[model samples]
Target: MTESETVRLGARIRAYRTMRRLTVRGLAGLAGASPSFVSQLERGRTSASVGMLRRISGALGITVADLFNEDDGAGHRVVRRLERPELPAGPGTRKYLISQRPLQNLEVYAGEFEPGASTGGEPYSHGDSQEILLVLRGRVTVWLGPPAEAVANTLAPGDSVEYRTSIPHRVVNDGDGTAEVLWVVSPPTPL
Candidate 1:
């Protein structure tokens, strides 16, 4: 691989690794490689053999081809509407994954909730990711932090919010009709 290609490949590895919350040492152990080796790969200091790429890809729960996908403006990708993957969320809620394949450091999903639908019964906490929810239709109430002391924000169309993933959060369709929302998370956390 060329120097630029190596760097870009390294970035892809770093993105997925962080999304999976794995340290260099952790991924190295899983790939049966050394921490320094992983670090050097991430820093574009070395080229991996097909065998090594397979090991790393296996350790990252992805395929070797995923590491070699054509760059979307250097990892920025366009996820078309029809191409977006559907995800299982709550009942009466339609969710679509927005990140283009190879699953990088970003996780984005668009959701449509019918009346009486919700994200879940309780809030959820995540690692060190940042989350943003933008309302595209109707209304919804977002509960943040502990249930007893939660702060509720009723959002309408065009409304958006940014919050820390450390705080427990959930969404409820507070409208009489269907509601739509776009959620984006950075350093993407698991569902």
Candidate 2:
């Protein structure tokens, strides 16, 4: 990354960390990093690898893409399709941040997944908010709760589901082809 970009990244990290009310040490512990490392990274004195950035973003309940965007969800009423920032995902999976940063009441995302791609191997919860997932193409399976006692629902085009964000959940593309989905969350929460 360029010098300016690195500084901006550090600023974003600091902003999110502060907004989450986490100290440098707390963030380091959650991200499996050292406090000094996080401090330096936030101060723009150092750079982080992709792996480190992913871990930190995960710990902060945000997407890596959020670290690069500067939009604060103010004054902009529309987000152009070609200008949407993308979140790093697993192979064959694409996640886009359709909503601006420092989310107000709502957060949105659009995703495309190749067959067999999934959000993750395990379910994860963000906070106490409401979420709606709508399938726009192909098929997907939504898993709620831990793997041991999870509820799975297969969704086709136009299918939608509403659930609490506090409940651990995962989404998988279980179709024969690529699947597209839209996620809308109210009272925006991290992750």
Candidate 3:
């Protein structure tokens, strides 16, 4: 892979890894690789083969296409609109369009949250699903369970987080500036 492609792949790997809430060591073990290998792959220092990527994707319960999809202008793509049926969680938030319509068995959105905003504060569940969140700006706190795994991790423009939808998870904007996230959910909700 070229430098740019390597970087993109690394970003995707990191995104999926975070989405699954798997540590480097954990993913490496699951993928039959070493921790250093996973770390290097996530940093773009190494390139992953199709086999490796397949294993990783399988472990994450996602299809290979999910890791390599480009924006193809499918369904109804929206820009900055706030009148749609936005998921009820987090005040002072907006969800822009990343996909045209919520078809194709998947959905993606550009989420913007003002400072001190949050999502799904009342402990909700979404059946059996998964969510991937890439932090495009500022910092946010993620709570992932009733036990409440407080992820105070700060994400810069290129950081991300992913987790199973079976467990209740919520996000809160904890930075001084607004937080922007690219959120992708699989198995489109019946809305």
lDDT of 2 at 139: 99
Clashes (backbone N, CA, C under 3 Å), per candidate, total 0, 0, 8
Greater-TM-score candidate between 1 and 2: 1
Error of 3 at 155 (Å): 2.8
Question: Alpha carbon lDDT of residue 52, candidate 2?
Answer: 97
Ranking by lDDT: 2, 1, 3
lDDT of 1 by residue, 74-190 (tens): 735677888788987878998998876566667788999999899899998876578899999999999998998999999999999899888999999989999999988886664
Top-scoring candidate (lDDT): 2
Off by over 4 Å in 2: 1-76
What is candidate 3's lDDT per residue for 51-86, written digit by digit as tens?
998887776656667667655445565555554455
Clash pairs, model 3 backbone: 18-162, 19-162, 19-163, 75-100, 76-100, 76-101, 77-100, 90-118
Give the TM-score of each candidate: 0.70, 0.62, 0.51
Model 2 steric clash pairs: none
- lDDT score, candidate 2: 0.88
What overall lDDT goes with each candidate model?
A: 0.86, 0.88, 0.71
Superposed model 1: Cα runs more than 4 Å off:
1-12, 15-37, 40-64, 70-80
